[model samples]
Every structure is written in structure tokens, then in C-alpha cells.
Target chain A: MSWSFSIGSISGIRIRIHLTFALFFIWIGAAFWNEGGMAAMANGLAYILLLFLCVVLHEFGHILTARRFGSQTLDVVLLPIGGVARMKCIPEKPGQELAVALAGPGVNLVIAAVLFILLGSQTIMQDVAQPAKNVSLLSQLAVANIALAVFNLVPAFPMDGGRALRACLSYRMDRAAATKLATRIGHILAFGFGLFGFVSGYPLLMLVALFVFMGASAENNSTQLHQLARRLRVSDAMITQFSTLPVTSRIADAVALLIHSTQHDIPIVDGVGKPIGLLTRARLLRALHDLGADGQVADVMRTDVPTVSDRAELEDALRLMDEENFPAVMVADQRGHLIGMVTLENLDQMLLLARLQPRE
Target chain B: MSWSFSIGSISGIRIRIHLTFALFFIWIGAAFWNEGGMAAMANGLAYILLLFLCVVLHEFGHILTARRFGSQTLDVVLLPIGGVARMKCIPEKPGQELAVALAGPGVNLVIAAVLFILLGSQTIMQDVAQPAKNVSLLSQLAVANIALAVFNLVPAFPMDGGRALRACLSYRMDRAAATKLATRIGHILAFGFGLFGFVSGYPLLMLVALFVFMGASAENNSTQLHQLARRLRVSDAMITQFSTLPVTSRIADAVALLIHSTQHDIPIVDGVGKPIGLLTRARLLRALHDLGADGQVADVMRTDVPTVSDRAELEDALRLMDEENFPAVMVADQRGHLIGMVTLENLDQMLLLARLQPRE
Candidate 1:
């Protein structure tokens, strides 16, 4: 996801274009030029641009609908093959998710309909159906839009059709089970696509097959994790005992603590017993390398540590830790008093226990 | 990455094969069978299988070389495009990284060389140039190996050529900076490949172009994070303030806590001052729906939770959170005494600071 750069935000959701998409455009242009000179090259470039615009609009449709259900839209990234609308979180409610999933194909359908109406009004329907060797831009775009809509509705994972299938099945079963079923169907579709592609001499179909197969597997894995997280809590996984150091403690004292104790990080607390900063072995080493071990702990302690309420859901906590790339979180009371620390070692132990225990 | 199922550990790393690879086999079998009957199909299938075996050997070369330098291999997942050997961490030393990356291509080179030498005296050598159209299995495999070696040497991120480029530049610049430079070059190369692909009528070239562009961008982003993590500490980004509840509290008490406090989860502690479990709002609501508000909180609390040590590296901690899908990590001392909690909110604040602060 981080492999792309955001071009801008629409209605609070960012829009990004993968670098590969730019290459795809360039290829189309070059191929056109080589096949039929500058005029054809320009026409092909225009068509690709128009298609990508439609792709962007289709993603926005999903983003807007997700917003309607109170879920945040993170971004829409355009890949060489298609677009992906990254939601901050999928709607837990089956209906809401279904609506959001359908919105994307809805946009494509609307585009295709509009194009059809315009072509019909101009009496160019025949020309559009059997596109000429050198067709007009408007007609080409219309045909491409229709093609996009139909292709995306092929009931494959990483496509709108697969999401629609999952959402519909989720109405009857748990999300995990629904995803598993959808993934199985996706694999079947991938195999079918690959076979069709080879027989028809269409290489693009092979790419689609690859995408669907990988996408379905990824979806299943993530769904499994969500199910696992649902069965666990924060307390059962948090670390309770940790070393604490006073803000006034000397760097020498912190160094001594590191040498004698198992702890590699020491929380620095003020006189009121409130955590003010964190003193880690790495920071201490850096300080010693520059300012010497005689320096005060306050001079080297990091003050931007993240904290969490002792009473918060483990799922939310894990999400936060992942987003922020934090190693540990300090637990505190409502009065902002530092209570304890939670870390990865504790989380792993919790997971091991959960896996070993029988499901209730 | 999700294209395959891991088989087992090899020198502490998992090995997997993409589903599309099976499709590749089936297609080869069917194509040859249709062209010239069972014997021809068997020959084609054998050739394709032999080519993939070369690919596997190439990947193993990279894995074994990395292990020699004390680097850990996480898993090797075979993609339709190629195999990806995930390392626990890339070697920081320029020499080690260069050696590990070149190992894959080196293996291919050896195979190609050996094939050419053996076939040089055989009658098959006369038709090696057009082996794809010919029915000779050994000849086709020999040609394929040569192509694989040459194609993989093209400068592209996540490829041997790109990594080699980065390693060379890293000696003079920072690793992140080297990655940025290499990625930019990769983008240019991707464009070139795309253009040539279009003009040459080779559709597979388009896929190679897309892979290069995306891979380069991913490498850049990963390098940036690695650099940032090296400079930061776990404690500097942990959360410290939180809420808690007694283990004996009722579901009604949880409801009251939710209504009166902003906290959405409560860690339940026993009389011995140890955390017994956690009760999340979602779970509490589910319990209330199933067992009524009169139910005891102990019956609804999740006892399996994730935790972290206050001293763990920030990056490692974040990876654990992602792997376990935990919302928060409880920090504890070496003796398992409750200390504090870290959450996503606090980590975000630290990230904001990191972005706002000027790099040295």
C-alpha cells in the first residue's frame, strides 16, 4: 500500500497512482505510434487517460458510499491492472459492506449507460458496436467503459464482483466463513480465467488470474486474524512488570540499570510519579557516544512516547501499535498516572495460549 | 505473497509455491497434448517443470548465501512472476547485501553455463535457438534458463540488478538515499521496457514493466522505514495513561463504566494486583445481547491478550502487533508486574512529531 504516492484527496480520501500505471500509459502511447504514427499514438494516449479517469471515479464511488456508513476512506490507488479503494476499516454490518462494495460497479454501470444514451441519440450505435480500424475518441471511450464494467463483474477476488459475493454471503454466515467461501470461488474463477486466456491467446487474462488467486488468499488470511483477535483481550496479553527511572536519574544510573537488569528500556517518571519520557539503551548509547555517560538521563530520554488507557480493547491497541510502529505502550490511569507497560513478548505468549486452547 | 501455502521450514525459513505455477503446468500439458498428442504434451510438461526447478534452485542460492552472513530467512513464496525470498532483515553491511542479492542470478548463470556445455556436443544444440517451437525438452529448458538469467539481470527493484545497484551506491551514501536513487533509476528502466514491449509486440514485457515500477517504489518505502526505526526507540512512542476495572465487576458495571468514561475497554485485575483479563465494549454488548446485563464481567472477559516488554525495539514491537492483531500491548517488568499500556493514539502523536521535526 505504501508503494504508491498520493496525488490528492477527495472528500477526505486520498487518491494515488501506482508508478506502474504511468509505465502502462507510456507503453500504450509508444505501441500506438509504432503501429499507426503520431495520430494513432495521440488517440491511444487519450483513450488510456479517459479509462483511468473512469477507474478513479469508480473508486470514488466506493469511498463515498463507505463514508455514508460512517467508515473512513483511506485512499484509492490506481495500479496498471485496475484501482483499489483502501478503506480505513470495512463496515462490520453486512448491509453496509454490501452497499459499499456495490457502489464501485454502480459507477461503471452509470458511465456505460450514459455513453450508450449519447451514442444512440447521435445515431452512432452501429459505429460504436463495430468499432472502425481508426475510430473516433468518443466512440472508443464508450466502448472501453462498457468493457471495464463487464470485466470487473466477472466474480473474481480483487474485483468488485468478489467483494459483492462476500458481502452477500456475510448476511448468512460469519465474516470469516463468508470470506473463506468467496476465496474458494475466487480460486475456481482464477483457474477458469487462466484456461480461457491460454486458449484465446489473451495474456491479460493470465494477469487477472494471478491477481485473483493472490488477492483471495490474502483476504482469507486477514479474515482469520480478525477472528483470532476477536477472541482475545488486552489484559491477558500485556506486560505487567517494568523498570522505572526518575527524571533526575543520572545517565550513569541508567547505564548501570541496563547492565544489571533484564530491562533494556526504562520509563522516566517525574516527582509526581507521572511518566515524562523513555530512556532506552540505544538512546543511552548514542548519548554516551556523543555527550558521555556522565550526562543527565533527562538529556537523552525520549519524551514522545505513546500511551494507552489501561481500559481499551486489545484489537484497537494492536491496530494503533501497527500504525505507529511502536514497540511498547505505557498504561496509565484516568488521572494520567503511569501504571505499567505492554509489549510484543506478552502478545506472543497470549497468542500461543489462545491457539493451544479449545474454542468455546 | 499470499499466492502460495508454506510447506515447511528450510534453515528456519518457510517455502511455498504459487497456485499459478500449477496452472502453468496444466497449460503446458494441455497445449502440447493438443498440438501433437500425449508424447508431445509429456515432453512440454517435462521441459516446463525443469525450468521451474531452475528457478527454485536460483532462489535457494540467495537463501543459503544470506544465511551464511547470519541473516534470517522468513519465507520463500513462489509468485507467478517469480520467487520472493523474504529475509527477516536485509544485511546492513554493503558487502553482505551485495553478495546475498547476486547469489540468485549467480545460480542461474551456473545452470545456463552447464546446460550449454552439455548440449554443445549434442544434436539438440542445432535447434536450441527455436526450441519453443521444437519438441525437444532439454533444448527448450536450456533456452529458458538463458532467458531467465538475462531477464533477471535487468535493473529492477526487488530484483538482483536493482539490489546490486543499491548496494554499490550504499558505500558512498546512506542506505535509504541509495535506495531512492536506485528506485528512480528503476522507474526510468520500467518506462524504457514498457515502450520497447509495446513496439516489439511482446505482451509479457508489459508485466515486467509493471513489476519493476512497483518493486522499486516498495523498496524505497521500506528503506525509509528502516532508517527511521534505526534512529527511534520503543519507549519514545509508547502510550502511558489508561483505565482499569476489578475482576469481580459485573456487566452492569461495565455498562456504567462505558457510559461514564471515554474508555472502551477495561483490564480486569485480581486482588493480587495482576491483570486477569480484559472486557471490550463490543464483547460486553455481545454478552449483554446473549446473557443479559445481569451477567458477570468475568464470564464475558477475554483472557487471551497480547503484551510487550518495555525494552523491545519499536519496529519489532509494531511487527508483533500486526502479526497478532492486538489493539494494545501491556508493558510489564521482568517479574510480570503490571506497569502501563501503549496504544495507537500515542504512536500517531509521536509520528506527527517525527514528520514535523527536521532530520539532521
Candidate 2:
């Protein structure tokens, strides 16, 4: 997402190109320039662009399927490695996941089929073995599409086939277990790919191996976190011993509370003891430097502290804290009087404790 | 962050490598394999690895400086394009930001200086111009570090120089205004890079251009949102009218309420009129199919419905709802009795209205 610019938007989904992707073209142009001059540069550019066009189509295959199942596509980013379609959420249903996973390679298969038909299958086969300079563009494209399909089907966390494999496995077990199984398989494949790349002096295979290995582990970690989150309530984790300050308190008082208490953020309450603002350590320090320690806490405190019901789910509270980039959330009772607080540090501690607890 | 594996950690900072970065070596190996076989491949690998070593040092430069200012570095990820140090938050002070920004290129400058002394500046330049097969690894790395320094110094968002530029500007102007000015300069530079790349048949420049363009716009968008958020309150944006369901209500009853009202989520209250849970339309529909319409609303309602105080800032409440992925946040008065709700739709409407409002 960083360093990527939207080239256009289609059906509400932005199509973005990463900055480094341009390097691919430059490298190709420079490589070809010495071998065959301007014509080769033009040819290389066209080929790479066409390849990315197919890649974009392949991502669309996944996007359209996800949209059909009610998951929104946030954006499709074209990286130097390949295109990635970021869905709002992956569908939980095995059937829906299977369909979405298969859709990408299916599009590639279709493209390959059409290219083979138009260019003739025999010519495509010859082109696959021959060097790029000698091959016809149509034949080269046919082979490239087939390669894309095969490459994507290599059972990895980020690969289409990896999701398809997980979907199948989930039908028999839990989603988390399925993800673990698929990730293991992906890692094994990645190791093999890396080994082969090293032995055969092929760097491309090695790069893919690294991506697969990381993707597998990352996916497993996320799934594990999701599993832990599935069984928590706000009451189980909220910090009940945090100190609160009155809205009338001075910045000096907040500074003292910050230094004397372990709390980095203190709630500022109104006359009826309802939280009106939050005096975060960062804000207090800033106020101390700029507005002086004599400034009123009400003037320096953040009034936009998102409050959550004490009875709410811990997972929801965690999500809120994470999303708002809030240091902490005020937990209130039904009448909205602050009863507790949920800080990121405490939430993390809760997660660690939960993981350590043996489950039935 | 999503697809990177930790190689190791140093002083609590995790060093990660994206799987795709392995491709850099593979690419170099293949390019040189034709020129000089295994020897060239070995030389290429050694050169690339050394270059990345320098990149790692460059990132550490930023990480160490940030740590000095008390900003935590989440991790440093090595991408095919370059290394990215994900800090918890950018320093608010102009001086701190400037130091953090300059530190990266400062590391490269030191590396380049040391390399020049060791390899000799004349030798480094000759090695850089020579083809891969003939270049010595040490000489190549010396020149590479110099190139890295120069390339990063190009003023652009996500680039160290751009941050330094922003820090300088913010000293004289407001942060938001300074960011706007820096981003404009970044965009202009990006446009120039893109045009030059297209004319010179260099794809690498184009990619850098794309990154700069997007980073500038993204930074601008975030600043605008932060500004808008600073001006609103929860009560100013909350929905006052909403349907509620008693805990005794059945799924069928909830379905009826959902169909009759615009509310997609209804608060389920206890006998004493305190909210006990939320019956979301999606949950109700899922329950209807699985548990039958006769199921009690309490059986399917989410107990973890995040709540916010009516007096909280609208931006904070909006952030909480967005983070929790809650359709609506239950708004309660000081006694914690539900008085209203804050839906994302209403939050957006409020933001839009706020933007259109005339400044004081």
C-alpha cells in the first residue's frame, strides 16, 4: 500500500501500481538495448506490459468472485512480483473460499487456452523452450499464461492454490487447522524451490521460495491470533485499577499523576464522574512544554477518547483500540460512567496469558 | 509486515526480509551466468548481499535515531526496492523528525566514505561503469552505497530526504500546511521522474516516480482526515432515534424490526432498560437459518457491542466503531443508559458536513 499510486478505479476498486514495478521495465529495456537496439527495447516493454495486463486480469478473477460472495475488494496493487487483490475480508465459508481461490488460476487457464488456440499449440511449445528474441509474441504470451497458472497453483499461503488447499482441508477440520496444514505444505514446497534454485543457479525460483516461506508462516500467525480472539470478553481483560483525573485538574497535576502512577493515560472526568477527555502521557508532555504545566487538563486532554461498554467482547475492544490507534479505550457501565480502561499493553498481556492457558 | 519473515532481532528491533528480495540475487545470477558462468554468479551474489548489508545499516540508522527520541521501531523490512523501517509513530517535533530522516542517508554517507577510502574513489567509479563480470565485489559495493545515498536523497514522500524537507518546512509553517507544500514538491519531482523515464526508456525512474506520487497524495489525505477529526464531537454526530429489542424478543421479532427500520443493528435491553447485547441483522439472518426464527434474540445477539459516551469526541467514537468494525456504537449518558447510537454512515455524513463548514 505504501509507495503505490492509483492509476485508475474500476467498479469502486482502485488499481494501484507500486513504485518498484517501474524498475522491472527499466531493467528490461537496459538489458535488451545492448543486444538489439530500440526495436528490442520496444518489444521488451510491450511484452512486460502485456504480461502485467494478464496479471491484472488474473487478480480481477479473484476480485469478481470475492465481490459475488459479499466481500469487498479494497484495491488491487501491482507489485514487481505480481498483482495482489486486497479483499476486505476473506470469506469464512469453505465453499466460498474455494471458489474465490480457484477463480484466479481459472482466468489464467482461459487466457492460456485462448492464446494457444490463436497462436497454435505447437508454436507455443517451441516458443517456451526458445529464447525471447527468436520467439513470436503470440506464442510467448501463450506460454507465459500457462506458466502463470502453474506458478500460482504452487500451494502457498498467498498463492491461489494455497487457499484452495486450505478450503478443502477446512471442510474436514477447523479453519485454523486447515490453514496450518496448508502452510506446512507451502513451506515444504518453498524449501524445495529454494534448494533447486541454489543448485541449478536459478535466482527466480529462490525469490519465489522466500515469498512462499514467509507467506505461509505469516498466514498461520494471523489465523492463530483470530482463534485466540474468538474467545474473549471485555470484562476478562479491562484494567480496573487505572487512575482518573477531574476535568478541572491542571496540567501540573496530570504531570504528577503521569510520573507518580504507572498509567500513561488518565481519564478526565466531569462533575458527575463521566469521562469527558483523556490525558495521554504524550499530550501531557507536549502541553507541559508548550502550554506550561499550569494549563488546565480540559484544555490539553483529548475529548475523542472512544469508550466501550465494559460488557463488550474483548476482541471487539481490541479491534477498536487497534483501529483508532488509541493508546487506550475507556470502559464504561450501561450509564456510561467509566468503570475501567483497556490499554494496548494490557490487551497484549491478556493475549499472552490466554495463549498460555490450557484449553479444553 | 504481511509477507516478511524475521531473520533475527537486534536490540529488540526485528529485522525481516520479504521473500521476494531473494529474486534480486537470482536475477543477477542469471544475468551473469551467460557472461561468466559459476564464478560470475558467485561474484554477483556476493556483491548483492553486500549491497543489502549496507541497506540494513541504512535502516538501522533510522531505527537507532527514532529510539533515541523514544519512538519505537516496530520492525525493519527489506524489500526488493529497498528497506523500510516501520516506526510506531513519526516524531511530532520538527527537530526529532529531521534527525530521524537524516540519519538513514547519514549512515550511507559514512559507508560510502569508508568504502571510498578502502577501495579508492577512482577504482569505485571504474568498477561501477564496468559490466558485472569484470567488477570487483568491494568496488561494486562502494559505488552501490554511494548510489543508494544519492537515490534516497531525492526529495519524495517515503524517502528520507522528503521527511527532512517536511521537517524543515514545518519549522516555519503549520504542520498541515508544511506537509501540503512538501507533498506538492514531491509530486512535482515524481512527475519529472516519470516524464524523464518515459523519454529515456528507463522503467526504474518511472517506478520511483509512481511511489513518490502516491506517497505524497496518501500523506495529504491522512492530514486532511486528522484535521477534520479535530473539529467534531460525538453528540454532534450520533443518531438520536433507533429501534431497540427487549432481551425476551425472538429472532423473528428482530427480523421484523430490521425490516421495518433503517437500523442494521438493534440494541437488546434488559428488564431494567440497560443494553445487554446487540442483535445485528447479519447475525439475526444467520440465526434464522441455523437456529430457526423461534430462537431468542439473546441467544444470537453480540454481547460485545462496543459502546461510547455521548460526550466523547466524534472522531474518537468514529475511530472506535471503525476499529471494532462495529456497524454502530451504543451511545450512553452518564448513567450508562443507552441514549443514542453512532453508525458509520452517520459518521461519514458528519465528516462531510464538517468539511463544508466555514472556518472561524
lDDT of 2 by residue, A1-360 (tens): 269888998888899998877766687788789779999989988898899999999999999999899987878998777898977667889999999999998998899899888878887887878876899877777778888998898777668889999999999999988988899999998999876765565555666788789978877766665676668667766766567888889876775554333356789998887888898866876776667757898888888878889778877776666555678888889998988887766554444333433341
Interface RMSD of each: 14.3, 19.8
- What would you estimate as the lDDT of candidate 2? 0.77
Deviating ranges (above 4 Å) for candidate 2? A194-207, A240-306, A318-330, A340-349, B1-360
Candidate 2's displacement at residue B250, Å, is 44
How does residue B252 of candidate 2 score in lDDT?
A: 67
Question: DockQ values for all predictions?
Answer: 0.06, 0.02
Off by over 4 Å in 1: A1-3, A9-13, A88-90, A121-125, A128-133, A183-233, A241-306, A315-329, A334-356, B1-27, B42-360
lDDT of 1: 0.71
Error of 2 at B263 (Å): 40
TM-scores of chain B alone in all candidate structures, in the order given: 0.72, 0.73
Going through the candidates in order, state the TM-score of chain A alone for each one: 0.73, 0.79
- Per-residue accuracy of model 1 over B148-217 as CA lDDT, tens digit each: 8777877776678888888999999988889989999899999888767655545557667888899888
